[model samples]
Target: MSYREERRADQVAERAQDREDMRLKLEAQLEAKKIAAEEKRKDSEAKAEQTRRDAEAKRRQEQADKRARQQEKERNKAARRAKYGKVTGWLNRNPVTAFVGFVMVCSIVPAVISQVGALADAGVFVLLAALLSAMLEGTAWALTFMGKKAEDEGRPAGKYRVATWVTAFLAAAVNYWHWSEALPNQTWVAVVFAASSLIAIYLWDMKTHGSHGKTTEERREEKARKQHLADRRKHHKDIAAEADRLLSALPFGSIDEEEAFATAWRIKMGAEPGLSAEVYANATNARVALGAAFELGEHVRPELVRAGMLATLYNPLPNRLSEGIPTLGPTLPIPALQRSSGAATALAGIGMYGSEAASGNARENASEKDGGSTGGNASGNSPRGRSDEELEALLPKALKVAAELVAEGNQISAAALAKRVGIRRDDARRLRDRVIAERKLKLVDGDDTELAG
Candidate 1:
């Protein structure tokens, strides 16, 4: 074998290898084409399924819309029938009102159009004249409806009702003027034209506002309610300005009228609503006196309780000595009941019988005076019995207090002086007289009517 033979063998082997490679490449291309065809078939199937689902949803929607339309049509039909039945029922129930309304429409409409047309003949714009006529009649009806609505809501409807009649009368006057000018000397026809304008509204008013047989009780209650409101208005005139101010200041509907009036009364009068300051003061004093009497009755002996009860039938004791004044008498069983009936009677006797009774009975035993002489046990030390030296010691202080009270604008009464100076009322009276004489302070009441010095 030579080198040429070896080369020929190599070339043959290479050709075999090239043919095998070409076969593999062709098979790969065919397999790729097959895979692409399978994918394309799957995509087409998916698109067809999507189209079917869309068609099915469209069909269902169309059916649902058809059913909804049918239901709506039925509801509309039922509503129309119900409306017709309501109209028939109302016409049957209010036949007279229905007839009146019919007459109002029949009489007023033609007259308004004719009268307004006459204005058009006088060179006014026909459309504008028609609009003016409509406005006149419309205004009357609008006011009438508004008035009825106001009445229903319990508001004052008088102005609206009056306005309605005014508009109606104006319309009537317009018609009268037009018919008189247009139909000259046909006064009867002109009168008819004017009456047409008024009669319609009159009948309408009768239909809308006629009382439907109100019961006697209802009428009474209505009258009473009106009277009560009138009385409240009359009585609260003094506080009206303050109440109106509050009504404007506060949010609407937050406080009612009566509550605002009450608050205003309290703010202005410094007392309860509907009560004058004098009346309130008197009532408060009475209550205080009653409480004092009850407290005294509880602590005193049964006989003294009976006596206090009897004493209450006539004039009662004062309620308070002074504002913020301390009770300085010795503490009996009850510290509050410092003023006794004996002291009050003795003081009264002094005032009535003059200086002899005052000088003689000034220093009474405390327990015997308060408890009404219960023998030795009641003969204790005098609580309010001050000596001349003690009275002298209290005089300068009492005068200073009286000056201070006068400076503060308080009247110097004996009880007030006594409470301020911590002395008995009689001693307080003597000191008060001396202070008045020394200071030349004018007495507010012209005389010491409580207990003379």
Candidate 2:
């Protein structure tokens, strides 16, 4: 109990309290750091999710672009093949008119020279005008080749050629009647000039379409077909025009995204943007209303579906339109209700047949069986239906194709769907599972908990 011993004990007690205080401060600092780490982890996860979403969208855009290119190449091939199947051989698409132009251009010179000796003659002037009009018409039609609606550079050209010949014949007759003195020489010159004009037209046609040509009957048929196609284009164009007009009047003020989307739908569906009954009562109104009907469907899909406005199975359009034809690559999106029809056919290749295709046998068998014996037996379930290898094969093919398509902004089944392609069905699903792993697969059903692993 000496004073020095008591002082030492007090110092030790003070050191213990100081050490306790330091321990408590360190605990508080550690707890704060733990909370900050959790917050940082959450932020990183959210950023990663956003990056994944962006990548998915980019991939889908690329796929859609690729599909569009493929479709265009196919269309060009079909057009080129069809071009050779016309009547006027190389000039079938516009033969008659070209002939008429050549004829008029040649005959007009002789007719006019003969008439110069009788300038005031009414019949001469009338003949001259007729010849000029015919020549102009033919030339105009030929120039139309530069336009997007000219017939497939085939049989239509032939028919137009002959029309020019008739004009030339009329001009030649007039020339003969007016100047008989030098008639023989003038006639030969006119004939030679007409031939040269026709030859020029031939050279031009050859240059544009190459040597491939069509037969006579084919040309006539192609001409008739072109006329029909022209009619169809006019019909669709008129509908689109009306829709565009209605959408422009909307008052979305530009910033409100919902209203902006609504306006766009109005333009697409041919509805009045104001949501008025006038549009509802019209044919365009029905298209607009389908949007609502689509929302109420078994799947939460838009009734009026659209891809990136390019040609697809859902949007086939024409490389060129005639006066009335519905241009190819511009078909409306398949209706949702026709799922078993258009969607199945487009997605599953329900009716396509080819050796390279996996669905061909299944499609043929389904038909042979007079239809599926049960509803469960569909495109892939015929008696001699798709083999396991075929199904697995399709998965990879579909995933490759669909992923590419999705990158291009195309809508497709997020679920693993095996269907037809041309004449074949896909035969594998492993690739689909792989895509799912990359988070590329978007499940259509929100309630379904299972996802491809």
Candidate 3:
């Protein structure tokens, strides 16, 4: 029994020793794995911290750079402001000039704003402004046409009466269109406004200035001066409109040399004021360099009649002059010019040429005459030259009579006064009769002959 028990006990002790060794190996392996995982986590956390710091530093640097740039811009702006102030101060020293400039700026800004609106239908306010300007301009043109006889004759042109009425009508129309979106309502308002304005202006100019019996000569002179000033405004308006039409036809980058020339030719063919020529030459340097190649021309006419510039167009014999080169000559046949991108280039050649361009002018004058004018057939054989002084003297009288006739309307009694005024006696009597009928003038019936106002 002792021998068997001893063997069993020894086996149990061996088994316990093997288990202890296995446990120690497992514990060592677990400790190594835990250390590796902790090292990896620390490395990842450190990398993240580094990234965050770099990002923060970069953002600070960006903010600093932005602040520096803003400072530089502000400094430049301050310098500009200082310079501008100096210039303004100098101009202000002269009150008259400063006032003129201010007035000009005020008028120009409004006109420019209106023009911008007209270019495209935009906000209601902008559209209204544009319509107002258009109406004023149109009215000026109409009045110009009506007052043509007086204006050309060099007398008082006419009052602002017509222009004001037209402006009122246009203003009303604009208010009705974009603001109210009602054409009929706007039109009716315009009609009423125009009528009222016309009546008021007529009263101011024709009636207000009139004396109970006879207006003072000084007052008449003042009225005439005002009328002439109004005419000057009308001329400027017409010129501006013509310039605008040309501008509309030639958009930037839209027209090549050929297209630009074609536009010029179309306008020239109409034979209206070639005011567009001056403006187009100033728009772009390229257009200026390509000058008369873009001008209007009909079938080649006699060179002698070209804008009275035929003599200048002719070539000079190089030997005849100091230069050996054959110079530009009048006898040279001016070829029908076609537009090109860079054929004969220079702004001097196209955009702006003073007396220098005379050499190239094929026909600047349009027509030439040795002795007579175009009215030879209709005016008979004798030709007369106008003496401006004579016209000046006669124009005033004619203007006065015409104005009276206009004011008299249908009721004027045309009689003896008509003859004195160099018009039909009947016309005068009609005018006199009209004044009395309208109660505009006082009239007393002298049982035998009626005395009239």
Candidate 4:
């Protein structure tokens, strides 16, 4: 009973195993089919994306080409406009010249031919009369052309211009006679004929003379340029000749006219253009004189005073007292000093003490007696304290003198004030400070404490 039951159980287990294997095989086949379908879908999506990208790139390239074509068209249009603008500008500027030329060619040729042909009808040789008319008008036009050419070249064109007018007048007279003879009752026709011949020539002449609708500013500039050129030629004839020589020596187009003139002026004048040795000397002298006037009181200021230069004034005596200008002697009294102070100072000590030394010494002795010692005062007062008191006494007078110097544009220093008012340098410095504080004046360069004595 156990063997039979075991064998049946084993067969049942085998059948169940076969069914499980079949189920797994079916699941694997379904999974493979799903994977293939997913791969095909991904490939289709990739192809679609590629097509879209290609379409976008092609559209962008076409748009870029369109923009390039449009830019090129606009550039071509602008270039055409510029080309037309230049031509129109030239035509606008020369309207009168163009009009006159057109009128002369259309009217003058026919009128002159007919007028001379009238002479042929009066038994003159036809060919000879035509040739004579052609010669008259041709000669006038030729002279006009030559005159304009000469004027443009900056040459003398007056004679050619006059010849052109004379020839035109002769032609007018011939036409006048012909018209007057042909239309005896209509004498105005003779005048009209005469005017027709002269009008074109006159307008052409005016155009060449720069009166063809030029503005007032243009005319003024032209006149000024002519005057300047004339003045240069008149003042610098030698340089002008040298310039001409140099211009002729060099290649025709190598050097500009003004450049040649400048070179020639440097070579011939031995100085800068528009300047001479005498003029330079005069200017230098004038400048030195002005500087010297500014330095009149500066000699007393050792720091501000320049070395190796002295200022002097040439004061003349009154006309009532002297016959001519009075010269300064070595020991003569200075008028500038006399005006500012009542005393006469020697020129030798004018920069230093004037007449203040004796007063300075007496005050020093008095300060020594009152200060009670030979040494400097203990209150930071140099020398004696009484000297400061004496300086305070003289401060009013020193201030008056300082004010006068300031009015004359002189930069006041302690030394200059001390010399003027017979005071010590320290007292003078105190007086200067009082003046500055009271008057609100700026501190000048020469009054440095570093340079104070």
Candidate 5:
């Protein structure tokens, strides 16, 4: 019993020792894992902080670059504005001579630089040549600048000119000496160079400060051109003013008057090929007279005269009277005779006040004639007797007469039309109404008294 019990107790103690060793090993591994995790988190945070600093630095660099670019742009803009102002101000304040001198200096400077190539190089010889060229050119430039300043200030530029000439001579002499070595016969070369230089200087001076000595014919032509431009400007202004006045005087709903004013303005401005200044002047005068008559509430003979003047202006040909002015529509049978007769009748009836009843009768007769009453057939046909061809042929003439009368602000009275055309009063009125209807002519101010195109 003693041996068995002791063995069992030993086994239990050994088991307990083994479990304690295992627990110690597991605790060591857990502590090592926790330390590694803490180190990993610290590394990640450091990396994020580094990336943020780099981004901040890069953004600062970009801002610096943007500021630099803006500064450069402002500097360039200021430089250009200053240079432009200087050049333009000088040009504006000086005469053409200043421009000529400037051009000469520009040309001569480039030529001198090219000829004296060593002056532009990078050596002792270059230094010497550059100094020499600079001295000469600088002196010339200074003189030129002074001359221009003096001219602007209304002071004598004689001293400036003398100094410029002296500098130019020195430059020319130096160039001549430099070129003489390359050329044969140095004496002749020098003489030729000196002569050429003198001639060039003389020519430059003449071109800058002397007259062109234009011929009488040239002077006259230039004068004429200026006068022509002035006249054209005046004509344009006058036409525009008149058009504005006409437009203002017209009623708001008077589209026809507006169109007429526009047409008249165009014609006056030489919209048509054959129109002349004289014709335009006459037409403008006529229009002004017509406007005055309208303003005065006297609208008959003045309107007719204006129409005639406008027609003449519209077709301003030397042979217009003889060949008959070309019209928009078909030709009339006896246009000259009709115009003369109508004009005479208009003049005679200027102050004659006809009764309203008579005017009403005339209008009614025209209406009845238009409805196809055959009363006054000169062609020996019924009222509707004329063929389509005859009617077409007569229509243009009748329209012309009616247009003239309407343009004159006159009513198409059957009696007046009959007297003018030598047709029956009823027939004349019927023809007038039919022409008006077919042409779609509108009555002026909703009144049967006046018609407008």
Candidate 6:
């Protein structure tokens, strides 16, 4: 009985053990499946992340490539511009050669295109025409250049200029004739083209070389010449102003005759008297008028001043007497002195005399009394009277008297000078003024006599 019971129990126990082993195997298989699915998901995520990184890198490389291409394009453009600039600069310097080359290219290329079948003949003809045009233009340019050069050198450019104009007209006519023959139906178009070409060449020439072909050296010289002229004009103006000032400063009163004579000499020698002949004449007239006024005991008149100036300029001495001084015996009457003086003749010439008939009668009477011609006493003096020779001859003596007056003292008046030199008061005043002006002396403000150099 014990063996049978033990066998049954053992069978049951074996069945239970088999059931538990199957459950554990199924659970392990399920757990392995879950882990495999998680690993597949992680691998997919990693691959996706790698693909995004690759795409981003590719996008960045493409942008860099685009920027590099743009930079390269800019560099190429700049290089081309620099090369073209150099070529243009060379062409500008050699305008004739450049124009010839341009003409040849334009003519030959067009002929080649239009006469493709007869290239050899058409090319030769086109080249010939271009050469002719270029030569004509060159001739004009040469003539202009030569003329400008001559003008700059101060030589006559008339011949060269005439040749240039003639040559230009002939060239233009020839071009028009050639265009008319080449494009008979489109003659107007050809004329316009030829004219435009000519104008272009002229404008180009003007741009490269000035119209006058003025070189840098010539321009500088012209500037210098203008400056020199301006300086000379200023100098002349200053001299004129100084002369006017001196004339205006003269006192309108009686001056000693000796002083007046001395002053005239000083003015002629040292006071730049002839800088203005008009001013000198005016001063002489004032002196003579002042003397006359003093002698007559009257104020100086405008008409008398003008008459005296004319007399001094035209006739400095009396016609009857060869010398300026009268013999010191008795004072001559005013009418007698006037009739004998050449000053009356000058006054007549200036239309200042009171009556033409009176002057004529006086001259006739003098001529009869002197037993000489109407003008002079068998001297070389003209009918108008004696020249300034007599006055000029007394210059030395007057100069000596002036030196003595200056040596005497700066505090001297016209009256004192007249008494000392034994001359008229008006003449003395004139002489004192002449000496002061010639020496560039400064006059004392209150004292009319005192002067300092």
| Ranked candidates, highest lDDT first | 1, 4, 5, 6, 2, 3
Best by lDDT: 1
Q: List runs of model 5 lying over 4 Å from the truth.
A: 1-14, 17-145, 152-154, 158-190, 196-200, 203-207, 210-222, 225-453
Give the per-residue lDDT of model 1 (tens digit) for 24-90.
9999999999999999999999999999999999999999999999999999999999999999999
Local lDDT at 215 for model 5: 85
Assess candidate 4 and give its lDDT.
Answer: 0.62
What tens-digit string does per-residue lDDT give for candidate 3 at 1-453? 598798898888988988988899899899888998889998889999999999999999999999999999999999999999888888778655465446535543444343434334544476665665655645644564455556556666546446645554554444334333324555564344334323333333333234235458978998897886466446555444444466577676665533443455455544233334544334333322332333322223323224323333344643321121122121112321221222212111111111213322322222122112332222231234224454345444533443343233211113323443443332333333333232211111111111111
Between prediction 2 and prediction 3, which has the larger TM-score?
2
Name the candidate that leads on TM-score.
4
lDDT of 2 by residue, 146-242 (tens): 3313456333555544554454455444444444444555766545533443444444454555645898899999999888646644655654454
Give Cα-based local distance difference scores for all models: 0.65, 0.45, 0.42, 0.62, 0.56, 0.49
Stretches of candidate 2 off by over 4 Å are 1-14, 34-38, 41-49, 69-174, 183-453
lDDT of 5 by residue, 1-453 (tens): 698788988888988888988888789888889889989988988998899999999999999999999999999999999999998888888756576666666556654563355344423476677666666667776786788689769899899889888877876776566556546466676555444434545556676577647889999999998887567547666664666666678786675544644655665665553365776566544433432232211233554644643464456566433233232211211232335423423321111122233245444543355434434553344555445565456667776676576556455555445555556544665665566454332221122233223
**lDDT tens digits, residue span 1-453, model 4:** 699899999989998998998899999999999999999999999999999999999999999999999999999999999999987887899888788788877768766776686668778898888888888888988999998888779899899988998998988888788888989999998888887778778777776675747798999999998998789889889998899999999999899878988998889766767766776566544433432333233224332332212223333433321121122112212333333231111111212212223233333333344333322223344564235566667666765675565554344445556556655556655765555343322212212221121
Please list all clashing residue pairs in model 4, or write none if there are none.
Answer: none
Order the numbered candidates by TM-score, best leading: 4, 1, 5, 6, 2, 3
Question: What TM-score, over all chains together, does every model reach?
Answer: 0.33, 0.24, 0.20, 0.38, 0.29, 0.27
Alpha-carbon shift of residue 385 in model 2 (angstroms): 95
Candidate 5 accuracy as lDDT: 0.56
Clashing pairs in 1: none
Preferred candidate (TM-score higher): 1 or 4:
4
Better of 3 and 6 by TM-score: 6
lDDT for residue 330 in candidate 5, whole number 0-100: 17
Q: Stretches of candidate 6 above 4 Å error?
A: 47-131, 138-170, 173-453
Worst 10 residues of 5 by lDDT: 327-336
